[model samples]
Target: MNPRSTATAHVDTFARDRLPPPDQWPDLRFDLPELRYPDRLNAAAELLEGGAGRPVFRTPSGDVWSYGELRARVDRLAHLLTRDLGVVPGNRVLLRGPTTPWLAACWLAVLKAGAIAVTVLAQQRPSELSRMCEIARVRHALCDIRCVDDLAEAGVPGLRITTYGGDGPDDLLRRPAPSTPYPAVDTAADDVALIAFTSGTTGRPKGCAHLHRDVLAIADTFSRHVLRPRADDLFAGSPPLGFTFGLGGLVIFPMRAGACSLLLERAGPRELLPAIAEHRVSVLFTAPTAYRAMLAAPGTYDLSSLRRCVSAGENLPAATWRAWYERTGLRLINGIGATELLHIFVSAADEQIRPGTTGVPVPGWQAEVQDAHGRPVPDGEPGLLAVRGPVGCRYLDDPRQREYVRGGWNITGDLYVRDPDGWFRYVARADDMIVSAGYNIAGPEVEEALLRHPDVVEAAVVGRPDARRGQVVVAFAVLKEGAERDAEALRAFVRAELAPYKCPREIVFRTALPRTATGKLQRFRLPGDGYAESSAREDAGSPTGRETGGDRQ
Candidate 1:
């Protein structure tokens, strides 16, 4: 199909037009000159081009699919999307499914066919899905058969939904393979390839548009420099492919190195431990919580084959790192990434890892601690974390773009301090700062303090409304098996480790803290007395709250 019509060109320009002015964009850097991408590029071609017979994906049941085999499947799906479904360049296609091999193929196929792939978490409800469709103006959908009813419930106008992975003859996997392969569509490097939605911990989900070049930039920088993967390395992770963390760790990184990945339908510690042993997986990507869970049953599985472990999606407590290293003799590679920037911009691997620090910026990226005026703060002073790199904030037609990309720096909503040695230590999310009785406290510092207690399994801290103090530190905790959930003991334990005002005035024990699909702690979900979004937005400009407008946007 000829996709070069003027109408098609206009349709594709929608995403590019929404980007902030060139003057506001971050200064993109590619240290390795070879990393400079061509103006006309397709991310799918870069990821799945030619490694002919190399194994690319392996199932838990021991089924292996080679790169050539996967590419053939992607070609057939691309033909189906373009020919049968009438998907055109720049049309937004919603992809809904778990991290299955077929779902992965479908994602690449959408990109290959010159459509924007909007991937949603498999567990997202109909309401969230509907809002996403409405916001993105999604034209078509490729959903797992189980999710079709919900997609239909979304009631998006003129939305054509196709089912995949079910018993129906029309299912994507069951459809007849195309007789002739469909070549990848030619797309500009700046063309919007994917629209990733944020976790929406605060309010509504905001879409972040990434270009074809941004896709390969992450692989070329982090995967090439820090991860240093081998062709035989088998990447495995717990995050859903919809999450950029998972997309980079499980798919792009491995593909860039000609390595394969083991896709788990479910990646809880119970499933992950056994699979690592059975598959002899070399690289593991997961959150800190999973590592703690895996420690509980370390004797039950043989994790001796694991050479590298990557932890992200949430703050990695020093205690979690120590416990994992003490148990496995492996230093966990800790990183901090965001949906706006596409993937990890700051991280440390192996000998460079500091127990509590998020390490230096990845090659080709620039990070610094800055104050309200976007000026760099002195080392060891807590301030807003700002970053800029090959990729930066480009929200899909949202005014929040101004707030996110101010003065050419992506002000991530994080509180961090860079030490004299250049390692950045995470304090808390800027919105998560707690103020009580005229003292400012970082919620994560208190969470870290609580985590130091032997009986505490999990902890999340937030500011609760107080009659006298305006707001007081409150904690929600998950206790170890058979441990007492006494609020006083927990408070006292934290008080000993931190200032008394920083300690949780009240600790409520829960079986589990609320978390996102990618295992990020959802502080907004913590119980608070009338901590309304309107009130928070009003205080977003306050200094003690440290909620800078740039950070929140």
Candidate 2:
């Protein structure tokens, strides 16, 4: 099916018209029969109707909704959107809320009505929300009553907002809705379905536009091939629905496989560990930090039901991976994905996993280690990682699109090495490499060594300005409770672990590390102080270190 030749169902052509010029777009390939979607398709209907009568979402309080029930809710919301709110096809609708059934229903409703979904984290400040609304040109919003304050205060001109999950007369759930099924919009398969912005903390956000076909392609490729699930699998995770990783893992992947997912609104490791045990979740998805935190309190969780675990949103340190496997006997499936490509593109199944390396590309995807000039580098040479598949990067009216997609491949800003065995090993982010005395040192390598230390729970290494050495390695470490705060001792430990030149010249002790909403470490946010106030508390012989909640998904 020639996607470009089909007539769009959108009444508003703003989104499609603003896409990067066709010449700059990466090569889009439908490499599998399953990826060849119909010309006229609504991704929500395709995902929901296939699993009718099957359990789809489960709440922590024992509440459950089957596929049929969720579909009816979504249909009602879709009908209300077009009928009452005057929403038309291609209208951008903002969705903000915690991870709940209502939030999921709102997302599907927007897609079902052929309206573009603009999902944002509930934690965003009013200023941030305002900036996002301006960037996407979003006016209509479906905000949870708890989150309405920020959206309303964002002051988006003429925003028609409908509050849900409230008892008020104007609340969306309070409105009388028809129970009959509403026909899903007949949108072109290439029509944009949702715009997922980056989860970084600083700078203006970059919105990644994804098509309706991409929503389903991720499930067909990664979910079906790498993390194969049975119909009875009970999934659970800590990521918010706003993040693409969570949207796929907690919702799309589970629904595509006819499995039920337990949605936790407060899903830190403390909350998620018990939820997995209470709900008997068979499949778990979270960042490497959450996995390590769970490993910290191992005996308390009855993790007998967990058979498959996935780690992403940050690099999975080999020491953390090995510790989890040794404790739970489940190998962490480490994968690298981006908001640009949608979901996990490179990952391995249970036995296919290599301990320290992100595995080969998934079926229907091609990846390579490329140098600065976009040419492929020899195996084992560190270079920029470039990949392309059914789903590729499409930024929403941002000039960075030209930089992200180059020469028919999405040049993910990750530094990687393709070993002779064809597995891709993560080095560090391209910008995270430090040049110390003409030797290139990857920060994650130093962090990985620090994580292997018994007392260190979390570590982040960055390049600090050093006039003599060009740039010196600096590490911020969060130690376990009661562990000694001896920076020199830790520096010596890394010297013994790796080459002495790679060792951090200074170690700063902190109670907690700064992270973005999706739990990725914001290395730029690290403070310049040699030691934080927590170190002063340690000097006074007082306990320091804060409890790590759930990581961003």
Candidate 3:
């Protein structure tokens, strides 16, 4: 659709009278001010100055760093980068390591020294790291000693590699002492502060360039509206510092709120629980899978200190939310954020939450459900989810920039429904929808229903190509411990709970479903040749009449 035509159509569907004016929303005090220098707006500089001599972070090892001490360390590293390493403004410095107070300091040091920081996931493979370095033209990489070997194997040449850990030449512990405080360089608002590489399910990764102002814009909108952290609140989470979700949860929001962040060197479900218990962490940010895993842990960990738990990266099932709140008094705040938006555009505070819904859009953003042609759908009808927020995403020279931004609206790949009261309920992605015999099915909806089953530990539903039907619903299930994986019994259970068309045509038992590093289910990996092999074995052993089930139309 043409740009002008699309805009006109969108306006007609969501007329001004039909939607509430943005100004009528509750005022959030965290909005970013227009700065004189856009390119050099360093968050570390702003927060450190305001929070000087105050505690910034706490570690489980009984280590604590006041803002003054953190700034002093950052200054020393900044000087070393400028003098010894010759790093300059706009230089892309790749930060590779797990979350640590030192890692946070290094991030600020790089930015404080006037260089753009590109955070690489510590768990990323050599090839993935290589692609990122090549795309960003990273001049320096501060990585863990364990990751240095992979960086070498990735063939990223001419890049200075600094290692962290025991006896390493460039260990953060051995960095030179600071002679003076590093001064913040003047930067333009449009200058890129960080580049986050998004995992592409279709093609090579794309770097989402976030401007300095964009950082504050996110903190202004979602953080103010959803989190509302106080100085006494200690924020922590399981997402690595590399993910924007973690960066916001662990550093930006807390620092913006003048609160302390607890940085765990290792953050998995196992590690996260202990850190929370030991440190009395009040706020958490993690994926739904991690929350589920924490509940499944063999031993009980004291989580009473936790006041707010935020879940993103994937759809939050109602069953997961109920299970979490029932076990612990905290409700998992469901927010929908994309790499483009930098943070969640929609979220609900604990008091305002509707269990399964993706909540109302933040004060500064507008969301609508649109049909295939980009026309807004009626309330309660599922369609493409489009959002327009203060923090706009500008891709680095990618054609997708044009495809994503249509008529001044960001068309997220997600499909959703907007209720009359304006709550947004997430459906499957437009690309992830399964079509069988002309029936359009959302995979996530089926997965959500399956999760409600007591015997089901985890399930991923995908479309499998069929000769009779265009596609058939196939479920990859991981049953609970001591639970039976009998195909017929499981199918019977699904048939009882879901519509005949929505029930899985076949159930394939697996030890576990494959997931991305961020804990999102990797549905693309399903319905591969492995499924065919498993199907062959199942069909060969099954009796003739048993193959056709009541649920199979």
User: In lDDT terms, which candidate is top?
Assistant: 2
lDDT of each: 0.82, 0.86, 0.74
RMSD, every candidate, angstroms:
5.3, 3.7, 8.8
Candidate 1 yields a Cα-based lDDT of: 0.82
Residue-wise lDDT of candidate 3 within 212-327, one digit each (tens)?
66677777778877788888899998777788888888898888888899988777788998888888999988888889889888887788899888998889999999999899
How high is the lDDT of residue 224 in model 1? 83
Give the lDDT ranking, best first.
2, 1, 3
Q: Clash number for every model?
A: 0, 3, 9
Instruction: Give the range of the ten consecutive residues with the poorest summed lDDT in model 1.
Output: 536-545
**For candidate 2, lDDT tens digit of each residue in 1-553?**
3336578999998888888878778988788899888888899988886467888999988888999899999999998999899999999999999999889999999999999999899998887788888888998999999999989998999899899999999899888888899899999999999988874334567788899999999999999999998899999988889889899999899988888989888888889888988889999888888888888864677888999998998899989888998888998888888888989889997878988899999998999999999999999899998999999888889888888888999988888999999999999888778998899999999999999899999998888777788888888888998899898888889999999999987787878877655567766566432333332232221222221211122
* Candidate with more favorable, higher TM-score: 1 or 2: 2
| Cα lDDT of model 1 by residue, 219-253, tens digit | 98778888889999999989988888898888888
The collision pairs in model 3 are: 37-187, 38-187, 38-188, 38-189, 39-187, 39-188, 39-189, 40-187, 40-188
Q: Comparing 1 and 3 by lDDT, which wins?
A: 1
After superposition, the stretches of candidate 2 with alpha carbons farther than 4 Å from their true spots are 1-3, 200-202, 528-553
Clashes in model 1: which pairs?
none
TM-score of each: 0.92, 0.95, 0.88
